[model samples]
Target: MTATTADSVLTARAVLLDMDGTLVNSDAVVERCWRRWADRHGLDFDEVIKVVHGRQGYASMAVLLPERPMAENYAENREMLAAETADMEGVVPIPGAPAFMAALAGLRLPHALVTSADVPLSTGRMAAAGLGLPDVRVTAESVGASKPDPEGFLKGAAELGFDPADCLVFEDSEAGILAGRAAGMRVVGVGARAAALGPTVHVDDLTGVRIADAGGGEFRLTFG
Candidate 1:
């Protein structure tokens, strides 16, 4: 991984993006749901929130409740997914996300959404955020393991027909950044949460980014 600097240029043949904190600001809903879960289990929401981002609900549960049975986590995760999908309150796109997506469309770069969110949850959240879904997606159901395992990002790169080294990832959470690195892709950390995670580059938001076609199946990302 490269140092996290505001000014940098990265070239890649494909792009993989994380949702939630990266493209969408769903923290309000995330905190609300996780707070309830934390309370129910007599855990601290503060610590739980730190582990919840960039991972599937069951994965987060496993980390928070290491001694709990996997079966129990899976069951609760299902319920949590349904509840989160049904609730769209406070879901909104990150600043400049709309323009960023539009820019990608204009450039026609190969890109995919590689998110820990299941199909329904991802779909609902993106809709609530008013962002168009990328044609290729690697959702929670698409892989056996979650973020920090590199499964989803690797799958996304494969589906896009690009090698991991040829892809660039945009992520916000520590788990997502680690997964991108594990997949051998350069990462552009998206928010304040991502600053200390050692992404190839860090930006305050999409507003600080500029994407341009660099010809020959490659795209250039300029961060400021």
Candidate 2:
């Protein structure tokens, strides 16, 4: 549901953020990469794009090519990662992402990045977006399963020394929202598509989101 003024003050001990569509604006690169992959594999680009967001490359590949061996999926994922890192053509920070991160730092609140991208790809995209890396990051290699499984978000909360219930997750895709919910955290959808996923709170973007000192290791999220 969309955030109302009455629901703006959300209290949490930590924040969990998704990297791609949530923070880094890599839509162009992501679509380009996936489209090329789909074309080469004889899959419908439109259909492939639908399930690729908020999922690990390997996981998405497995869905697209269910009959492929695990080893082949891994190999293809590595190649995709390399391609993504090498091409930073349209990467940039999403609106309000910089300010939201700044608020997190300013409040001295704990936060972790939970992403489906592996280390190299995540780092490259973040760098291209001009976003600083968080203290704790949960990438594809860090968890046994990707989003829609809750493993990554659970891992992120654990690494941040916070209970899942005490963390607020910010996500931009349906899979991520489901994962956050499964992790027992309140989720704030960060985009229109995410909003459609029925997160606890939804915002068009991070533009007016701010952190307020709530004292005693807790902070209030002021959603604009």
Candidate 3:
């Protein structure tokens, strides 16, 4: 949780990215769907949204409806995923996401998408945001536990053929920042929500991050 200065530089062999609030700004669609869910469940929409950002649908439901059956949560999660995937009206990339992704691709960097979104939902949302998918992806279906558990980031690092300590995670939620740390990786917190959470570095958006080859299969991430 070392905060960054304009001169800060982090070197890593691989990068792991979170989707929703990190790379894609899908808050509009998330609000629409979750608000409806909250109404149906007779819960507070404000409270529900607070817990929904970094978790999978079932995980979020379980938090909001602790007494609800796990079977019911899974069932409803399927429906929620469908609704989110089908509605991409307000989905857009976070600032500098397009260029950041392009820079990674152009540099042939080792990177993976580690998101709470399942395959279809991730695909649709990234498409809507006009962003390219990384070759390695650890989606909801790929992990048994959600963020704050560290499984996704660990798997992402393994798939990228790097040790967790050699990888850097870019995320925008408390759950995500915790997960990255638990995985023994450095994390770059993105967006306003992440500013309050302690990450290895904090940035308003991807625009504040500049990555350049550091030689020997590593890259240097300069942050402000």
Candidate 4:
């Protein structure tokens, strides 16, 4: 579903951002890798990618190849994905990423990156995108559970020295969004089209989104 547009700026104590689709444009690389993996396994590309977004690579592999040993599959996919050059075509900064990150830097609010991407993949993607990652980073290994479990985002909040209730979560996938909301933070859905679960606000991209850290209770946000 198309997300609801907001003109109101949200207030929060910290900001937590998703990496792949939210801050970095890994869509093409993700699409390419997932497609190759699916084709190798004779699985449907669309279906695999549908479940791939916002999930640890191994998590998606387990769901896709239920009969296979998940650990082995994860290893294989990790190896395959790594063999790919770090810099790939279509790898770039997501819309509004530069502005959003700069704004976060300027605001001086507690901010972090929470991603379903495993540490290696997340780091590679970030390097390819050339995005300045937040100091607080929560990767797949950060928690036993993945998105939709509230672990990743919550862990990120902790790293940022803020309570979940005081953080603002930015996500593009359903699992990520669910985790954010369940963690008790105001959710901001970022994507061209977000499947309608729900969130405090939704924007097509980070373009025009502004943030201000209000010292104590919350940080204020302005969106257009």
Tens-place lDDT digits, model 4, residues 1-224: 12234556677778889887788877887788778888998999989888987777777787888898877976976675575445467878878888888888877877898987766777777777787877888876688977788988878888888888778888888878888888878788888645375767877788878776666746678777
- Per-candidate TM-scores read 0.96, 0.95, 0.97, 0.89
Clashes of each: 0, 0, 0, 2
**lDDT by residue (tens digit), candidate 1, 1-224:** 13334458888888999999999999999999999999999998999999999999999999999999999999999999998998999999999999999998889988999999999999999999999999999999999998899999999999999999999999999999999999999898999999998788888999978888878887878888
Residue 59, candidate 4: C-alpha displacement in angstroms: 0.9
Q: For candidate 1, what's the RMSD?
A: 1.8
> Relative to the unseen true structure, what is the C-alpha lDDT of residue 151 in candidate 3, on a scale of 0 to 100?
99
Q: For model 1, give the 10-residue run with minimal summed lDDT.
A: 1-10
**lDDT score of model 1?**
0.92
After TM-score superposition, the amount by which residue 97's alpha carbon in candidate 4 deviates from its true location, in angstroms, is 0.9
Q: Candidate 3 regions off by >4 Å? A: 1-6
Q: How close to the true structure is residue 90 of candidate 3, measured as C-alpha lDDT? A: 85
TM-score of 1: 0.96
> Regarding TM-score, does 2 or 4 come out ahead?
2
User: What is candidate 2's lDDT per residue for 85-121, written digit by digit as tens?
Assistant: 8889999898999888888887789999999988888
What is the Å distance of residue 3 in model 4 from its true position?
A: 16
The reply for model 4, stretches above 4 Å from the true place, is: 1-7, 84-87
- Each model's lDDT: 0.92, 0.88, 0.92, 0.78
Error of 3 at 69 (Å): 1.0
